[model samples]
Target chain A: EAGVTQFPSHSVIEKGQTVTLRCDPISGHDNLYWYRRVMGKEIKFLLHFVKESKQDESGMPNNRFLAERTGGTYSTLKVQPAELEDSGVYFCASSQMRTGELFFGEGSRLTVL
Target chain B: ELKVEQNPLFLSMQEGKNYTIYCNYSTTSDRLYWYRQDPGKSLESLFVLLSNGAVKQEGRLMASLDTKARLSTLHITAAVHDLSATYFCAVGSNSGGGADGLTFGKGTHLIIQP
Candidate 1:
């Protein structure tokens, strides 16, 4: 089975620009999640989607960051007016069940300068 | 608030040596996981340990969790160069699935040299 897949493996944008990262999870997987890892920092959770419904989004940094899952198939994370601090590797993951092993995608590296 | 801490952020060992990486969390959680990642690569799941006193082993790596101590340990036996990578331990907060997202510890970079 194919693991989680992400698009635009690398993105470089000027500060205040907008960039959207996309993720395609495995088929029939009900859980999709977003996480980020800043340089020199640990990976941190961003949000989660279960079959098109947001299960939890408490980890999102601010209003400038938005995530959407359409029809419970794929997910997109959009950073509006991206800031320098937004430069990081964004990872998308999916699991067959809750509390199960997560399959990760080749993360999208975002560079906001 | 939830926090995960890992010790010996860097490990340098000779092939055939044995060592353990430790993970400690600030809150109570029964679900813990270990993952491996090569440079510029996606994370690969290694182990999922749930419940107190749970233990799981695969190949040369063994993971054990002690809910009473709020600690999890990843033991590498007879390490080899192929075992070199960043190892991460994450603690799942709340009772539900990791859909809540995992609180990951700063990874432990392991280097095994011949």
Candidate 2:
């Protein structure tokens, strides 16, 4: 089975610009997650989606960050007017509901200058 | 707030040596996980400890959890050069059967040289 896949493995944008990262999860997986690692720090959770509904999004940084999972097959994280601190690797993970194991994607590296 | 802390953020040892990485969390959680990640790679699940006193072993790595202490340990036995990678432990936010996100540690970067 294919693991979680993310698009635009690397992205470079100027501050105040917008970038969107996409993640395609494994088939039939009901749980999807978004996490980020900044400046070689710890990986932090951003949000989670169960099917098409957002289970929890408390980890999102601010209003400038928006994540959506329409129809539940994939997810998109959009950062508007990105700041320098937004430069990091964004990882997407998926798993079956009630199963603690998570399969992660290759990650989308964003560089905001 | 949930927080996870890992100790010995960096480990450098010779092959055949043994070392243990520790993970401690601030909240009460029964589900803990260990993951391995190579440079510029995605996270690979290593072990999942579901309950108190749970222990799981694979190959040269073993992970054990103590819910009462909110601590988990990853023990590497007779480590080889191939075992060099960053190891992370995460605690599930929801103690019950919920698909909540995890709180992860800063990761233990292990390097085993010959």
Candidate 3:
């Protein structure tokens, strides 16, 4: 079976530019999550989507970061007017069961200059 | 908010030796996970500790969790060159069948020299 896949493995944008990252989870998985590792910090949770619903977005850093999962299939995270601190590796993961092992995608490394 | 700390943040060990990495969390959690990430690679699932005293091992890597102490351990036996990677421990916030974002510890960068 194919694992989770992310788009544009690497992205570069200006400080005020916009960028969007996409994630396609394993087929039939109901739980998808987004996490990030910024600079030298720990990998932090950004948000989670359960099918078409936003399960938890408490970790979203700010309003500039928007995430959408339409039709409960794939998801997208868009950062508008990206900031320098937003440069990091964004990871996407999915699980068939909520508490089961999560399958992760190759992260999208964003570089905001 | 839950806090997870892992130490030592770096480990350099010779092949054929043994070493242990530790993970400690500030809050109570039944779901603990271990993941590995190679340089320029994504995270790979290693172990998931569900309850107190849960133990799981694969190949030369063994992971154990003690819920009472809120501590989890990853033990490497006879380390190999391929074992050099960053290891992370995460605690889940979800209950039942819901998805909750994980709280991860700063990764332990391991180097196994041959």
Which residue pairs in candidate 2 have backbone atoms (N, alpha carbon, C) closer than 3 angstroms, thus clashing? none
Candidate 3 overall Cα lDDT vs. reference? 0.92
Using lDDT as the yardstick, the better of models 1 and 2 is 1
Judge candidate 2 against the unseen true structure and give its global Cα lDDT, from 0 to 1: 0.91
Model 1 DockQ class: medium
Predicted candidate 2 versus true structure: per-residue lDDT over B4-106, tens digit per residue:
9999999999999889999999988858889999999999999989988989899999999999999999999999999999999999866544437788999
Give candidate 2 misplaced runs (Cα > 4 Å). Answer: B95-99
**Candidate 1 lDDT by residue in tens digits, B9-82:** 99999999999999999888857999999999999999998899899999999999999899999999999999
Each candidate's chain B TM-score?
Answer: 0.94, 0.94, 0.93
Runs in model 1 deviating more than 4 A are B95-99
How much of the true contact map at the interface does candidate 3 reproduce, as a fraction? 0.78
How far off is model 3, as Cα RMSD?
1.7
DockQ for each model: 0.70, 0.65, 0.69
Q: What is the C-alpha RMSD of each candidate to the true structure, in Å?
A: 1.5, 1.7, 1.7
Clashing pairs in 3: none
Q: What is candidate 3's CAPRI-style docking category based on DockQ?
A: medium
TM-score of each: 0.97, 0.96, 0.96
Q: In candidate 2, how many Å is residue A39 off?
A: 0.5
